[model samples]
Target chain A: MADQSQPPLTRIQQKNRDLILEGALSVFSVNGFRGATIDQIADAAGLSKPNVLYYFASKDDIHKTLLTTLLDMWLAPMIRIDPDGDPLEEVMTYVRAKLEMSRRFPRESRLFAYEILQGAPHLTEILGGGLRQIVDRAATILQGWMDDGRLAPVEPRHLIFSIWALTQHYADFEVQVRAVLGPGHDPFVEAGPFLDNLYRKILGL
Target chain B: MADQSQPPLTRIQQKNRDLILEGALSVFSVNGFRGATIDQIADAAGLSKPNVLYYFASKDDIHKTLLTTLLDMWLAPMIRIDPDGDPLEEVMTYVRAKLEMSRRFPRESRLFAYEILQGAPHLTEILGGGLRQIVDRAATILQGWMDDGRLAPVEPRHLIFSIWALTQHYADFEVQVRAVLGPGHDPFVEAGPFLDNLYRKILGL
Candidate 1:
């Protein structure tokens, strides 16, 4: 059956779907797309297979729902990177916000990583419409910063790419990172100074 | 039966194992550990189920062998980064080598991505023994560069992490990158100059 309940669903459907998505995030983040099974997701969700199927038509349907929902939240911070703000400050804010998300929502980050690693088979449209357009707009803003001498001349797209790589590394490679940083090193402590220096040095204001 | 052939395997044995590994990489890279099947890999290698099992005891064995082999090759260039060389040049050479590998051996890159993405389930020991040790030595070399002011002051470990993230992003997130860059764009062409400027600016020599 379709989700007949509207945007703000009745308490029961809301609770059930929320539970399923939360459980699904954990399972999907670790096992990845092809690796995740409906049974695992159902078990993790504490719902029977038929009960899960009652909400989502199939495994692919559940995955698409999670991914599209993720895309909305994932694009929010970048959308908040105001084109009108101080270039350095705006970009630095974006960097810090992204890193904070990596620390706080590592599961979501890994889930995204798993999908992208598997080639975004279920997300070509979202990638095209949502992510691609936002990146283009951000690139245009970055180019303006370069032209205005508000930031050092760097490839706008690559600048965005570097920002992403530097921030996300903390989450995506946490195992390797923590191992090298040593026990109790706390990546966030180093992350602040490291990012501060990176932005300062790169922007060259 | 195990791989009973001695170190000096007959040409047929060598070729057969190589074929199986090639097939295994494709399956493993596209699908994470839990998602891949012995049937698919065996079929890809042109061997019956039992014939494939003769070469590799189980699917896990095949996956482990593939990752172990990749780890050896993956760490080669870093091991070759001469500490005695000019710091910028040494780092640059390492960067170029990694990027080149991303282009040439993309499947290996993707295979490694899949493993790490899944928490490095089978290769944690290798990470500690092989990868961590090499990173330690590499970090020391980078520290020397920083102490001598041959390279800008940055955390050696994080610098290495940055390089890995930036270079690997091209191969691991190829779909998203290509999608945004558009149909006509060649990522490597733009990537080369972007990275050259990046390290140069970051090192600030």
Candidate 2:
């Protein structure tokens, strides 16, 4: 095992870490944090348990790393909502970005869902800290838009919540979506226009 | 231990079954299916493992029972959408019912979310059968509303999905909601008007 005080990871160490994280994402997304195990993650990563432990001290450590990384990526789009952009366009762009994330990074979305579903035991601090900060900033921008009559006045926080709920549902609840849509139905392909119309109508744009 | 082929449960047996199911909901909702154990359920129920087993065949059996029971309750609101009522009223009623379910049956909502996140391994048949039937019938009603220009023309199915996403987000993501809103924020109370305005605006009511 590598020493706790060791220098920066060599190239090989970095690669192994990535592998472990990728495997952990799949296992944790499907099985949830409590359901997942180091052994399962190790097996998925094609590494020995000790080898997995070498990079991350414990299952919790690995989970923490994964969650922090995910939170950053998950919040990136919201952070990118340009304050100076046309209000409707900014909001729509954020919606599409969120929907695209749902389609492309479904496992990541599900992982976050799993954490939230269980009351966010591991993420309470981040949720209260980084997440709160970013969301507050974004909500202010949305409020500004409403004040300018650029969008229909609504609860900024709740409006953001609505956008998350609508887009992430396609990924987090993929099975139900597919089951209802039946075979050969790609939800995202249709979701784009469907969501655009709904938001446009709601915002009175 | 009670025999598998025994006659109907006595009053004592009925009481024990209720205790076990109630306990199972707490454990299973927190831990998800794979993470939950019979011992945990038994402990929660204040029963011996053998006694718990006597009442239910296995963990799968217990989960299946919980899921089917939940499905019925979950779909009851959709089933109540009146075909002959004012289209907007019918739709909003369904929305309110679903939101009420989110507030009143949060554990059940999270339980269903857990199942769906893992690909609905335990609920495929029900989703395709009962759920599909009700949603399809509701979609037809929504389509009728659109046909009469009582509601804006949109994909009825996606609209229903949107409602579920919005309402359920308050429940399933309760932790995030609470974390972001901080103390003194009751999402359900505010959610009622927030969602009502959203649907009213979207439906052009």
Candidate 3:
């Protein structure tokens, strides 16, 4: 959020901030908010403690930066649901985008999962305000599609939840998924068609 | 696990142990394994830290106990998917049972989520050995049913994951689910029919 108001930094400063955020993401994803510490983040980031602190005010600050940045990325796909598009294909696009995120951005997905699992103390405001509005708008659009028989009727609001659940599961529970599938199988690659078929079944291909 | 080998606890001892475990569950559910402490568990359990330690050796001990106990309850549902039962109904039974856990035992659900999210360090053995065997058995049964066309064919292993992801989302992401739906909606209640329709579509009711 303050990304807009903060004065632009030199390339070095920007690079250091990215390293700190990347390191912080690794530590925080494993340890949650309570267990993570500045020293750990600094070590993971390959910087001295002072150097890390110079870029961010506190651990909370780094966590928030990661989360807010994440919230934007998280909401982008939903916001891309165009009302004028073919409803089923539009949804399939969202599904593909989310699965691609799970494949490409698993650490980010786990970090988001940890924050939410911990009650989203830093996130409750945006959750109800920004996130809810976007979800509601998407839900309404889905509802319209359903009413017109352009989409199969289920709870439009909850259908989004199913999408989140199915796609994010690949990332959030990757270990369990790998364990279940055993060797020589890529969970995400297999999941692509399974999910494509699933949404098609629910929404009518 | 030691419940089998240890001398049967006296009624008082059993009651005290239950209290400590219940308290530990509350703390550990909110605080992941690394973030939880003996004093906190004792405080939540209404016992002295020493007393809590007496019942459980350390924080790790308590966490392991909770996890091992949870593993049993978690497997009970999947284990109950009878090979001889009606195919779709059996899957529905598993779905309903998982959802019921989300509703009645959300903390447990989040605790399990937190554990898995962190790579299941303490649980990897069971995950790969005991858990894999059961899931394999269940998957094989479903695959057999699919082979017979008694159930609609989807990826049998992955379908189990979808069940877990959808049902557990209500518990693990309760805050997000609530915020998205706004006021006056019970996520679990609404989820029941939506999920029923979903699985029925996938499995062919």
Residue B186, model 1, lDDT: 88
RMSD of each: 2.6, 3.1, 1.8
lDDT of 1 at A37: 85
Q: Calculate DockQ per candidate and list them.
A: 0.72, 0.81, 0.85
lDDT of 2 by residue, B1-205 (tens): 4668968889999999999999999988887898789999999999999999999999999999999877888899898988889888888898899999999988899899999998899888888987898899999989998989999889999999999999999999999998888889899998999999988888864
Candidate 2, position A78, lDDT: 98
| TM-score for each of the candidates | 0.95, 0.95, 0.97
State in Å the error of residue A121, model 1.
Answer: 0.7
What is the fnat value (0 to 1) for candidate 2?
0.85
Q: iRMSD (Å) of candidate 2?
A: 0.9
Model 1 stretches astray by more than 4 angstroms: A1-8, B1-7
Give Cα-based local distance difference scores for all models.
0.85, 0.91, 0.92
Pairs that clash in candidate 1: none
Q: Second chain of candidate 2: TM-score?
A: 0.95
Prediction 3: B-chain TM-score: 0.95
Worst 10 residues of 3 chain A by lDDT: A1-10
Regions of candidate 2 where Cα sits further than 4 Å from its true position: A1-6, B1-6
